[model samples]
Target chain A: MVRWEPGTPERLQRAALELFATRGFEETTAAEIAQSVGLTERTFFRHFADKREALFHGQELFVRAFVAGVEAASPTASPIEVVAAALASAAEFFPDERRSHSRVRQSVIGRNPALQEREVHKMASLAAALADAFRARGVADPAATLAAESGVTVFAVAFVQWLREGEERSLGEIATEVLGELRALTSAV
Target chain B: MVRWEPGTPERLQRAALELFATRGFEETTAAEIAQSVGLTERTFFRHFADKREALFHGQELFVRAFVAGVEAASPTASPIEVVAAALASAAEFFPDERRSHSRVRQSVIGRNPALQEREVHKMASLAAALADAFRARGVADPAATLAAESGVTVFAVAFVQWLREGEERSLGEIATEVLGELRALTSAV
Candidate 1:
């Protein structure tokens, strides 16, 4: 019989990130995160499966946006074009306000090998999901998988550039630019 | 005093792969691996940092071949061409004799989330190493990174296809074919 509060998830995430940054991800506990936000451990569990999951709260939304973008694109669009469109649409999930938090989050992830592994797993899952989206649109093998993987690669490169200190480019702009480079590289052979 | 044994590392690796396959990766222990090889735990540690590393023994050789291939390529070659040539050369490291063991290894890795993460990390490290090789060759930032990442992608797709049952194509042949497909895909846009 616990009371539900608005913004509890966001509050927990913010508190977890702060504690992880200050005390390190391995040292931070779910209980400490709950206590920081004046909530119980049960409430925190209601939002996140574990302390590590808090940092990846946006993953589901990002995947959904990417898939939906691919599904909604014109059927006549090429695989790479579909991937580019999906990336552009998914870029909206990371608003400007999240930039500093993301930068901190990347640093936290960078410091821990376990977290780095989790990051790679997440990217692999995203690529698989995007590939499935392509398949659903009747795109065939190899091309679908390649385009999806390339999309994830573009997102990764663009996200890093966007997170750089004092960088002003939007995620969409950077992703498009990176995709263009990929296309140019692929075509160069 | 420890008796030096010839082929201790290779024997331990073979024992580890067999045990990991028969008993499962998580259920297998370092002590068991050492016992199976009639080697001391100290000998095992001298070869591998941990049990997980045994599955990735070829990674160093693979990276060395990739980097050497890139270095040996003509300076005027395009980034994609350099990457393709590197992948083709690196393919020589995975001969037909290793196919069955590789297949088993991939299955063991596929069944475990932690192992899958390790695989992704290994691939990411390879890509980073290739990118560094490109940079050493005087290639610029984004292009070097993009080409390296794309090369890894090509290798992954080709490797999977080459691993299919009844597949007779050599790794180099498969990689070259995949690279050709990538070129067509990119040029189609």
Candidate 2:
């Protein structure tokens, strides 16, 4: 099994995404990924169980930080405000230097049907986590589910816009703009 | 390979859900499904290619109707309004009589990971179809993608509520409520 060391997991993930996009995910071996990153295959196995796992390793921590941020936000904030706070907190885990790599990773994952399915599962789990957090915070009826899913919508839209802009603006700014568009879209209806 | 006649496919689907929920999706055979519905194995094969497909056939028509409705909506309507109109049109296809069988289908599908994955894929496809419809209209930006995804969210929330209410309310009303909740949540930020 690959053990993920601090910083190494992300480097391996980036390397894997690059290789996967270039060589195709099915064609690229874990050994090739490790060698390209100047790490041993054993180390790669240590970080991720397999190539597929590498694409999703960051999501565990991403979910935790996001839910924490939502739970920690002021109780008085609106549901969307709470979700936006959560997204902002999760955003800290991503580095500015890696936006291009992030875009590449998204593209690679997007092209693969299997990877896309797993991505959907990941998003669903994150929405469930957010809903649970909202429920714990006393939001009832449709608010918890609506806020969680709406937050996911905002995240997806913002991330795509961020990719399209290609470092022209900060991630936070893209997120804000997407949220504004969503607000306008919803309210204008 | 199979083809569904007018009413036979829905009957087979209903029968399959009942058997799947009582035994299991994997444990149930086409013969058993057909026998329960007072049909033959050949008849079952005529309506569904296999057991798994019976669970999913309606989704295609549902998605097609959703896209068509979105495209036919007033161009002046906002993205959210367009989504709402599409959902309303889709809801018309799911009458009160189908809700019980639908809930059974949901429960059966929820018990299996493969079925859940298939469900997610179907939903994603529906979202993609909706996005394409939005793109066909004048609205640009990632609005198509955002609206499509948000429409799925609305559908999910509404479907769950409808399931809980057990045919007490029309699907259209539930969908409208879910859309309103989404709008409220987004605007509250």
Show pairs that collide, candidate 1: none
lDDT of 2 by residue, B125-187 (tens): 888888888888977866778888889888888888898853599989989988887887787
lDDT of 1 by residue, B102-186 (tens): 8998888888887888889999999999999999999897888888888999999999998899999999999999888877776
| Weakest lDDT window of 10 consecutive positions for candidate 1 chain B | B4-13
Each prediction's DockQ against the real complex: 0.72, 0.67
Return the TM-score for each candidate structure.
Answer: 0.93, 0.85
Clashes of 1: 0
Backbone clash count, each prediction separately: 0, 8
The best candidate in terms of DockQ: 1
**Two-chain complex of model 1, DockQ on C-alpha atoms against the true structure:** 0.72
Q: Which CAPRI level is candidate 2?
A: medium
Winner by lDDT? 1
